[model samples]
Target: MNIGFIGLGIMGSGMANNLLKSGFNMYVFNRTREKAKELEDNGAKFCSTPKELAEKSDLIFMMLTDVRACRAVSEDKDGFLESLSKGKVVVNFSTVHPNYSLELREMVKEKEAMFLESPVLGSKIPAQKGELVILSAGDKEAFEICTDAFEKISKKAMYLGDVPKASYVKVVNNEAFATSLTAYLEGLAFAKKIGLDPEMVFNILNSGALSNPYFEFKVKKVLNDDFETHFSFENMKKDLGYALSVADEFKCYCPTLAAVNEIFKKGLNKHAKEDMSAVYKIFDE
Candidate 1:
């Protein structure tokens, strides 16, 4: 299948590589023209705009940052909506508002195209290894047709039955991750301040119920002070903002998430100039 991919950031670039390696023909675009050139060098075709890329491909995968960027690629002049042909499919892998995904679904149908909300659960490393878990919602036929591509780019694909639900699932997952990571960082910092060896604390943590991939992977980065951006503070801030919006819409109280949201905000403030891992620094203070 010929696929068009937009947003060639770290995660998007890794996904595009996996698609090409999976033997699918790829047409690419990114706001930064140089990003497209980098993919072109890897044997992918480049398009000057979303419309141009959409016109030449059967499927379009968008891995942008937020709802605004998603809209920019979906509805702007010469965007995906203008160039999508009947029966074409557009899968959004960005984490954004479920309501926005629903709106995009309707827009795609108006164009006689299918829209799939496919927000993912893993970050850079999982994407690089094609181990990311895909949370998808759309027409069954569209899901079936894209199964092979999903398999090539992810370790698993979940069919969530509609647009907004997938977005909800993504936000819930992220809220949990952000909250747990914050708690872990705070406890670790407290232990260190009380004269416990940070390394020994982590060793005991691994031996207890606290051990998991997220902690194992991130604790190392925290200790090493490596705040390189795989995911950014900017993106997490957007996700937290959307999660709280969902809470308000549903009249739900999520005190833990609200607290973590503030910590994430503080982390972003302290390291507004650094990476998402800078979130750990808030506790260190």
Candidate 2:
């Protein structure tokens, strides 16, 4: 299949490379052309515009930043929708508000094309390793058609049956993660304040019933003070904001999520571009 990928950001670049390595014909585009260089060098066609990319590919995947960027690329003069034809699928890997996913579904439907909200769970490392878990919704037939491509880039691909479901699940997952990470960091800071070694505290936690791979991975970054951007604080903050919006739509009460969102918002003052682990610095402050 001829696959078109837009937004060659941290996660997108890795996922697109896996598809190319899987032997699919790949076309890529990015606002910053330089981001597409590596993929181009790997034999993927680099299209200058979304419209151009869409015209040359059978299925399109977008891993854009937010809802606004997603809309701009799909609706602008040289956008993908301009060249998107019937029977084609457009999968979005970006984390966006579930409501917007519904809108995107309708937008693509209007063009007689199928759409899937397929936000993923994993960061730069897992994406590069082709181990990200894809939670997808919308158009079962389209999901089946893209199974091979999904398998190439992800360890698992789940079809949750319709727009907004997968988006809701992804938003909720990120919300829980933000809250958990904040709690973990706060405990670590408290441990340090009480004259305990932070690394020793992490070691204790890692040996207990609460031990898990995610925390194990993040704790190492925390101990090393590595805030490099596997996933940016700004993006996590954005996802928290999306979670709040989703909760409001469903009339759900989420006081903890609200507080966690504020914590990420505060982190934005200095660590917006750094890894989400940089939130630990807030506790130190």
Candidate 3:
């Protein structure tokens, strides 16, 4: 398949490399040309802009940062909107608000191309290994056509039936995850405050019912003070904010989660660019 990928940050960079390794004809573009250079050296074609990438490929994947960036890349001057046409497929892997995903679904459909919202659940390592959980939703035919590509990028690709539904599921999923992480942080912090060895606390948690692979993996990082950009605090803040918006839209009562969202924001100024594990620094501070 003729595939194009934009947004070559940590997640996108790994995904693009996997696509190239999987033997797809990959066309890659990043706002910073340097990010695309590695892909170019690996046999992926480089494009100067999203529009140019769109012009050259049948399928385009975008993993931008947030709603604003997603919209800007697909609709701005010299963006992807100008070149989108029939028979094209645009798969969005970014974590964006459901309402924005709905808007883009229509925008691409108007251009006679199909749009799929497939927010992934994994960070740098999982993305690099193609072990992501892809929650995908869109037109059935488009979903079917994307099956091969999806297999190349994720361990599991769920067809969620429609655009905003998959987006909604993603938001809800992150709500649970952010809240869970916050709960972990609170417990760990409380342990240290009470003079319990934090390592011993983690050891107990790892051996108990509360433990899971994800929790253990993250907590081990926390114990070691290793917050080396698996997923940024600012990005977690963005997802929590969107998740809260979804809760509010549905008239759901989530005061604990609401509080957790504010807690995540506490890291924005200091640990904004670091992994979400850096939120632990907030407790220490």
Candidate 4:
């Protein structure tokens, strides 16, 4: 497939590189043209605009930061929709509001193109390894046609029915992740306050039933205070906001998530560009 990928940030760059390595004919674009240089060196074609990329590609994938970027890329003067035609598929891997995904679906449909909400789970490391799990929804035919490309970029890709379902699930997953990480950081802070060694506490936790790969992987970063941006605090905060929106839409009471959301909001002042694990610094403060 001739694949067009937009937004070559930390995650998108890794995924796009893997596709290029897999020998796909890749056409790429990024707001900052410099980000696409490495991929271009690796034989991927660099397009100056989304419309140009869409015009030459069969499947266009967007791994943008948020809904606004997605909108601008699709509706701008030289947007993808300008050149999108029938039989083309546009897959969005950005974590966006499910409602917005539905709206984009309609817009793409109007262009006689297919839109898939296929937000992925995993950050820079997994994306680089092509091990991220994909949560996808839209037309099954579009999903099927992209299966080979998906395999090149993900460990697994699930088709979850229709537009917005996959987006909804991605927000819920991030909600659980943010809340759980916050709870873990709070407990570590409590341990330190009580004169217990936080590292020792983590060792105990890692030995127990509560242990999982995320905690194991993150504990080292937390202890060493390595707050690199594998996934940014701002993005996690955005996902939490999306989660709260979903909660409000369904009339669901998510008290813990609401509290966690506020904690992330507080971190926005200082740690927004850092890793999500930097939420620990809020407690450290």
Best by lDDT: 4
The C-alpha local distance difference test score for the whole of candidate 2 amounts to 0.92
Question: Tens digit of lDDT per residue, candidate 1, span 16-86?
Answer: 98999888999999999887776798799988889999999999999998888988887899897888889
Pairs that collide in candidate 2 are: none
TM-score, cand. 1? 0.97
Could you tell me how far off, in angstroms, the CA of residue 30 lies in candidate 1 after the best superposition?
Answer: 0.4
By TM-score rank, best first, the candidates go: 4, 2, 3, 1
lDDT of each: 0.87, 0.92, 0.89, 0.93
Better of 1 and 3 by TM-score: 3
TM-scores for all predictions: 0.97, 0.98, 0.98, 0.99
Q: Tens-digit lDDT track for model 2 on 91-207?
A: 999999888899989989998999999999999999999999999999999999999999999999999997889998998899988898889988998899899999999999889
Among all windows of ten consecutive residues in candidate 3, which has the lowest summed lDDT?
276-285
Please list all clashing residue pairs in model 3, or write none if there are none.
none
Total clashes, candidate 2? Answer: 0
Worst 10 residues of 1 by lDDT: 268-277
Off by over 4 Å in 1: none
Total backbone collisions for each predicted model: 0, 0, 0, 0
Ranking by lDDT: 4, 2, 3, 1
- lDDT value for candidate 4? 0.93
Q: Across residues 132-211, which tens digit of lDDT does each residue of candidate 3 receive?
A: 99998987788889899989988999998977888888888878887888788778998999999988998898788887
